[model samples]
Target: MNKCIFFFLSLYLLCFQSFAQTSSVKTVPNADLVYEKTKLGEQVNSPYYEGQPVVSADGKFLFVYRVGHPDNVGYKTYKKDEDIWVGERMADGSFSTMRNVGAPLNTATNNAVLGISGDGNTLFLYDQYNLSADYAVTNIAVSERTTDGWGKPQSIKIKGFRWVSEPAYMNMSVDKRILLISYANNRVTFGKQDLYVSFLEADGTFSEPLNLGKDINTAGIEASPFLAADNVTLYFSTDGRAGYGNLDVFVTKRLDDTWQKWSEPLNLGAKVNTPFWDCEFSMTAKGDVAYFTSGGQNYGENADVYQVKIKEVARPEPVAMIYGKVLNKNTNEPIATKISYTNIKTHQNAGLASSNPKDGTYKIYLPKDKAYSFFAEKDGFFAIKENIDLTGLKTYTEIERNIYLVPIETGVAIELSHLYFMQSQPTLLPSSEDELEQLFDILQKYPTMQIEIAGHTDGVGNKQKNQMLSVQRANAVKDYLVKKGITAERIKTVGYGGSRPIASNEKEETRKLNRRVEFKVLSK
Candidate 1:
């Protein structure tokens, strides 16, 4: 048995156990589980140069940047501007022939794909779009995947971010909350290129870059940082750590919420590392297979992208996949919208995804052992948050949950999806924060809107006491909104004790559905 040391099982998720307890964990790499590496061959690797490998979150797309290759934008036989190439993963585990990603992405200047969003709807590009025909300063840019190829790349603003000559690499977190970058920011950089982190701000811009500190960065160079789906496990290449090569790939676990502390860096061993240069490790949600670049693997002193199967212990922390469609409740039709999720206990922005415009489907990967509140939003739709508990999850899973958004209008009684109360009391539980905050937001957006709060209980409860308890719970919610500055006159409350059971009351599973809080628009 794997001697898993989950330090804070005694702590509750409500307390945010990951950071609330010990700042230590053990995820030993199983040497037997690592397979031999295979080069990508002529399609990706060429005589000129091939390096800086990046794989999409879904593992469907693999992109690499090349230098001096004839297939480049300028087709330079000598040293020239870089160009990005893309390949799709075939069913048989082979990648298709690399095709030059032309136009806006590949110019007379260097270009690369640093990261891709979890939903595969967004791409994190190498540099800004507005530039002279000559090479310009490099900075990260973003582009959305549209029906018409990709949308125009937009350069994002990062406070105090500047670059001149040194190379840089970055990876956007799976939830898009954090950006892990390897760059030489002279201000905080301990030495040459050091690993740093930037947080996603409320306005969609990135905060000022903060060096990941001495534990992970050194006076040497750190390149190609890849933040795994778990957000805690980080894989990067560095000459700072003792390894098999000049620059070897290493895995490190983040000790706490602070981007500073880290576990001792572990080299990937000779199986994945060599006496030359080995780096750029990327994987999908499953974390079973890895795609990286190994220099001089096929051609002498030339870099090539390679793939290998890694065992569970060496992979990133396991995560579960949630996928489904956002549909209309009344008409049962597909709806194209943005889906958002939040951590109920911590009340933090967890992740984001987009439903396909044509099919209304969305996919998101989340870490196990936590609770989440997720939903889709539209102007006329009430963005009710549905809950999911992965606290007991033990393996990778694909959970399909179709969200149905109900129209917001007069007399539309929409039950609060994830709202809950303390056992038999009227106190609102912490998990109710997401739904209530959403309700508050909708009310604020539409200033003149009025709503009624109704509470219900299962039929097994005492009639009079149940009615009193239900009313108290409804009042509790009303008080919450009122304290938040909403006018009391615009809100009303009622309780239906065991009268409107939505499901069978005999079993606790279905009976819980009957005990719920709902809201109806009194006026709009």
Candidate 2:
């Protein structure tokens, strides 16, 4: 009898030890980490439950799921239906009052925002059922931003699949070509819930969904998947793996282009994950800051959105973030304009954004190892052109530049900073296309306006040869614009040669400024 009791006690102790090890949060790898975690406060978070937060690329707007709010458009009863809410970030960095996203999106049922496109023009939402009110049916819908407001939501149906049950969350790549989804009751789902991916096919239909396999999914709940802008790192919440709580956030990296292989999942550690539910993880474009839902003392009885400075050890791939306001140079008033950026090396578009019509703020993300040409343009104002060089940069960076657009006038002249030419020849480089297109757009907008294309050279070569080359360059621009359907009579060409110097021609930087192409309005 004594031996039997001792053996049972030993067994009990071993089981307890295993449970303790598995349920305790792991310490972060680094010892000296600098980070500050703060709750978003009452302006954005209410007494009701809130989760599933997604920030816009510009960081000016936040979309989230709010539950049990009486004012919610879809509120049938307290916590039965969830609705999407939007909160605008103020100039002081605090959030304004939360507002319901409204209309066809919220129809007295459960509708939640899953993700938003990088341009802030498309919104992804998951509806609990199709329009016909079919049982156990789910649909992933998208609403595009029109000139007036959000248009009607359209459901995305998979080819040959039926009854897509409970689409819990979804995310898309920066280009919107690949979609990452977390749904339940599919044929290939490994568990009660799993993560899947679909590609946007050339036919404008989404391909069949493919499960994300055993490496990322298990026979347990896996939901709230978020793919970072870098397109390689993925974050999701799971309960099948060893974690401190019933659900915890985990991150994995795509091993290759195949997307089938991935690195082993790693827990985000105690700093970000806690003993309670900590999920719905998302990061800013630069991945420097993260927002998530946490249930703690700060949040009375439900989950609330919280933010923390992302430490170096847990960040995604390095990227450079450009964010600021676009204002009128004369009156300092905010101006609504379209912002476009392109990679100069690869000749691919980096991304695009629009300044907020009310505040004129904008933000965009640029990947490393390429030079970029950024342009800001609006009607009745001269376009602003600037260059950003990120080649060989090894770390993440944030640039805050306030762009000032000059109003167009007869005497105002604007330099075409992105126009490039071969060493000594008048042939236009392919890199000059983006800038030339901007000039073409300006002419198209103001049809009655006429301008002179002027080319200048630095005082380095022979005077007569320089003057002749300048003339060739000016005529080259005029010919290109004319070929693009612009009236040749509207554009006149001139060669200033070295006569007009905007800056001293002593140093290489100054000389480069002198060797330029510009346009001055001749008439309006």
Candidate 3:
């Protein structure tokens, strides 16, 4: 009896240890999963084919390509109906009726909607604006949102580029830092339709295709690579790996900064994979639900967009989707602009998003475990800046922050936006100095402008102390400007303790808003 008990005890310990280890690493769904197959409802699908789906980062819109649809802008026959379509996600987790995204995107030549930037303001489409005689998928083109509508599709200059195999699929990372592509019938190859990656160059062009190597590329084929919001986990379709059928979807985690190193690919299992051709996998920023395309065993028959709930173990690392709009502070109207996110720690730009030229709305993905600073810039207005620390975020989060750029003129006052300091003291935190330097630069630009630094505090502390603290904070800001070579007399300081509040101080959440430093232009 004692020996049996000891054996069981030892076995239990081993099993527990193994479970803990495997749980830390993302696991692929097994073949046995009764995958709750996804559907787009009757509103979006027809008797024809629809593939190559790109879900917006917010998961509210979906872009895809269809074949043999009479409504296609260039529809001649089932083989010739290669036009892009757009649809909105319904409340029930399916799509509403899809319609032709229309001109500029749809032309006489055939193409597909390959990718959409995280901001939902740019579309990476199939084939260049000018297609070859045969309409072969050659390169990628981009179309950006304009005040009128989507502008003309412009081809991206991938150094040393050429043609690619049909259904040539691609995807962009959340930060737009890297672009993943799958192609064949070209210069370098491990096999047919091998996967490749192109790093975004400093000049806004993509580097030459860098093959993912033999571990990922096999002699068979690989295509439709989608990098998740985390930018480390990847989902792709290939016939090279061992799977149920001709083309199956697989998931792998990147092992290092060098794009070549990756974990062993795992089949997403029988549920998501069919013996038929399956490709174009994507997910929302949350990564809990997924969207892809699968062709039934029949040729292009039953080809439609798919959506399914993702297993927890298969989900990528969590990320924060920060979004909102840039508006004119005085008029309260949206403005077209470029929003840039930076790593506050290193003070290096991490990525950029262009707000819709018409609406001024924008969105960006910030990976967990770091501090970030972002701003929106317009020529005639002073840029509003903000800093966010995401180090403690362990799950997917959505943060909405708006920027109101004040016009640089007399009577205009804007909060410093990112001042930090120790509790109960006026000493500016190291993190806050960069913003002060920005102020100095503005002063240098407009040599004759005079400004007033105003300090504020929450209503929680002692009233007298709060007043004193606010005054000291204002003086601290003035001293920094004075030491930076600005004349001391050109600046004025004031403190509005708990008395004047932008928000009610009844709650801690709103109270924090009251504790801020703002500068008003005394003269310009």
Candidate 3 lDDT (Cα, 0 to 1): 0.80
Q: Give each model a TM-score.
A: 0.87, 0.73, 0.77
| TM-score sort, best first | 1, 3, 2
Worst 10 residues of 2 by lDDT: 25-34
**Cα TM-score of candidate 3:** 0.77
- TM-score for candidate 2: 0.73
The residue-by-residue lDDT of candidate 2 on 35-133, one tens digit each, is: 456899898888788878888755778888787888776565545567888899899887888898888677677777777766576777774436654
lDDT at 421, model 3: 73
- Residue 413 CA displacement from its true place in model 2, Å: 5.5
lDDT of all the models against the reference? 0.79, 0.76, 0.80
Error of 3 at 147 (Å): 4.9
Clashing pairs counted in every model: 0, 0, 0
Which number leads on lDDT? 3
User: Global CA lDDT of candidate 2, please?
Assistant: 0.76
Candidate 3 per-residue C-alpha lDDT over 98-156 given as tens digits, one digit per residue, 9 for 90 to 100: 88888989976676876778898888877557777776555678888888879998877
Provide the lDDT at 285 for model 2: 65
Alpha-carbon deviation at 474 in model 2, angstroms: 2.4
Candidate 2: Cα lDDT at 4: 96
